[model samples]
Target: MLTPDALGVATASTVKTLKVEAPAARSAGIKVKSVEELVEKLKNEAKVI
Candidate 1:
């Protein structure tokens, strides 16, 4: 997982433009702290697994 600090460093070293789009809903702010959590969310909440 790329932490904010790591992302910052990567962006600083890159020459290409990067675009970030905000979540369309407030629930998007929900944080998944690990890959297992993310997969669980995708499977249960999103039902896309």
Candidate 2:
């Protein structure tokens, strides 16, 4: 019989890392700053004022 502990010890596969395919969907390059800067940018640059 093979147990999880025995397999982990035998194969050293206990650790894993997750990957994100689309950084753009995750908003990778969106720069943000303080509340003042955000308000200013929203008002002036993004024209959400």
Candidate 3:
């Protein structure tokens, strides 16, 4: 995770580049069963909601 200071410096830099990558899906199948379940997990576990 980027610190606040590091994020500020990165934002101020003239050269801007963004890269995003997704991990390969597990062979066991989907982790969360459904969208609602996923949202619930995010809210309860991740506290992202």
- Model 3, span 1-49: residue lDDT tens: 8787866655455875687689978767459879999999889988999
lDDT of 1 by residue, 1-49 (tens): 8687866655355566688888677544678899999999999999999
Model with the higher lDDT, candidate 2 or 3:
3
Model 2, global lDDT: 0.77
Tens-digit per-residue lDDT, 1-49, candidate 2:
9897867766556777787575545545566778898899989998988
Q: List the candidate 1 regions with Cα displacement exceeding 4 Å.
A: 1-28
lDDT of 3 at 1: 88
- Report lDDT (CA) for all predictions: 0.81, 0.77, 0.80
Candidate 2 residue-wise lDDT at 43: 97
Candidate 2's error at 11, in angstroms? 50
The candidate, 1 or 2, that scores higher on lDDT is: 1
Q: Tell me, what's the RMSD of every candidate?
A: 14.6, 8.2, 13.4
Q: Give the Å error, residue 10, model 1.
A: 42
